[model samples]
Target: MSSIRAVLFDLDDTLWPIVPVIQRAEKLLYAWLKLHAAPVTERVTIESMRERRQQLMASDPVYQRDLRILRRTVLLEAFADAGLDTRLVDEAMEVFSKARNEVTPFADVLPALENLRSRVMLGSVSNGVADLDAIGIAHYFQASVAAHRIGCAKPDAAIFHAACDALGVAPAETLYVGDDPLLDVEGAQKAGLRAAWINRVEIGQDRVLPSHVTPDAVFGNLHQLEQWLKDNDPLTR
Candidate 1:
């Protein structure tokens, strides 16, 4: 182990439970859509909208690779198909984005991040289109990398390497913290960085470890992550 000059984090499930947050945001967006476009409301339910979005993405080869673009494209197509004005799509997306940002992180996130901030350079590497500024955590990161912007998503060594390059640190000296075992841990390891899994679900109990991507450490939450940082001599190589 060496002193951690930088720390990279994963967004979505790693920072907070994204599914519920997005669900709530979509609900809010749908409510707004109902008010603004009555005819569209008559034709599509939220569930159906989601299904159509999936179908549209499945039919498009490029969208199958980039989820962020797929999301935007899906929203546009859904609005068109529902006979809604296309101009409102951007407004609706903006509303949903703001609502998505109002998510409550796990109790441990802020305090742990506050503690680690002074100790190391922190940044985020996400596979989706999360704007850290929208989430009000932008100040905490020195850099934020998204897969859509980077042209490469996680599980790809290039993306991890790009993050490391942006940080001006070698991968061997950076520690990446993420929730997914394969995408976060294994991917980081393959890129030559130490990886820690934030296993909030307690699902590791019945799972056999995958051969290619073992995590250097695992934590139940940010509290455990802080403890790991303090206990380990990060400076010892």
Candidate 2:
């Protein structure tokens, strides 16, 4: 409403669905482990590996912010237990990272990005370790902030502030677009930026926000968000 000069996004679910991508990556990583570190595979399954990651993060919350470290640590520990060369952790991560970055954006994503970038500066702030450059959308954003790199995650405000600083805009003049109600909408609002919830499906179906959390706007697709921008900001219109 204050004439948005910049827009920051949450990468994983905002631009593209992440669950399937991670699932596929995990499958590939597990296959790779089975081939190279056979002993580790004998003791570990993909589901159990995921559980170990969860347990590790539960023990030391810092791993929740540093996903890469959490993943590598899990692999390293598995390698150690199996008496396999721990150096294979690097190769294992490379395999997973490559598979993880292969993302297909939502149908409305590219068209809306092309339209929005012409109107305002675009940046991304994500808690996940998604490689935007590898995903081939790096050129669309002026800045990309990852929680692991910034040492803070969303809902903390520092990650959002980092993105705004990188974009050379004040939080009040930026709109943060994301899919999560609490992590993205409430988090952005708490960080002093306007929040727009991008719910591709029917609302209150899969998830609902707390009674106290209210987003500035909500849309089903990026096209609607682009139109909202043009309607709200006359300069862009």
Candidate 3:
């Protein structure tokens, strides 16, 4: 209910739809594999590669904690499995990483962000290994705290606290906006900050509200979010 001095965002699904972009990136990676790595190309299909990556990731708790390392680990294993050079994993990962950066944000994002930037300090707190600079949105944030850099992931209070620390603001004075109900909303609230749910998908689930975690406000998309910011009640509250 106080004036929000800063706003923290969740990357991936919050900023842009992650599923489609990842699918496209993987498709591209597989095409490259088929063309360049003949041994790997013959041994594994794209679906199998994805399955292997998931299985390998599940076996390692550390990999689950940091998505960047997880991605590199998966790529390395895939290369190793195909009897190809492991050293090429890094180069392949670079290509995939660039593909990841080529995301298109929701239509309302730029204008909303442009408007919000002048009013409050903007920063990011992500559980993944996305480099905002690679995505060309680095200038929009004052700080970006990722799990790999901080050595902890959300809904751990330490990670949330670190983001607030980086912004030089107390938890209560900040607003955390994210897509995941548990990880973003509940986690931020537990860390003593107000939270907002960017529920872009109308999944018809009321599970995130007033139960597991109660967000201060909820919006269906960035357009609604922009309108809310213009009204100022959500941010002021």
lDDT of each: 0.80, 0.90, 0.80
Ranking by TM-score: 2, 3, 1
Higher-TM-score candidate of 1 and 3: 3
Query: What ranges in model 1 sit over 4 Å off?
Result: 56-68, 202-212, 234-237
Name the lDDT of candidate 3. Answer: 0.80
RMSD of 1: 2.7
Candidate 2 local lDDT, 1-237, one digit each (tens): 478999899988789988889999999999998888899999888989899999998999689888999999999999999998999999999999999999999899999999889999999998899998899999999999998997888888999999999999999999999988988999999999999988867322255667988999888889999989888888666
For model 1, residues 1-237, the per-residue Cα lDDT tens digits are 566788899988887888888899889988988888766777778898788778976786556446656766767776788777788888878888788788777777888788888887788888877778877898988888888787778889998888888889989889999988888898899899999988776423234457766688888788787777777845421
Taking the tens digit of each residue's C-alpha lDDT, what string does model 3 give over 166-192? 889999888899988989999999999
Best candidate, lDDT-wise? 2
Estimated TM-score for each candidate? 0.88, 0.96, 0.89
Select the stronger candidate by lDDT from 2 and 3.
2
Runs in model 3 deviating more than 4 A are: 202-210, 226-237
lDDT of residue 96 for candidate 2: 99
Model 2's C-alpha root-mean-square deviation from the true structure amounts to: 1.6
Error of 3 at 105 (Å): 0.6
Candidate no. 3 TM-score:
0.89
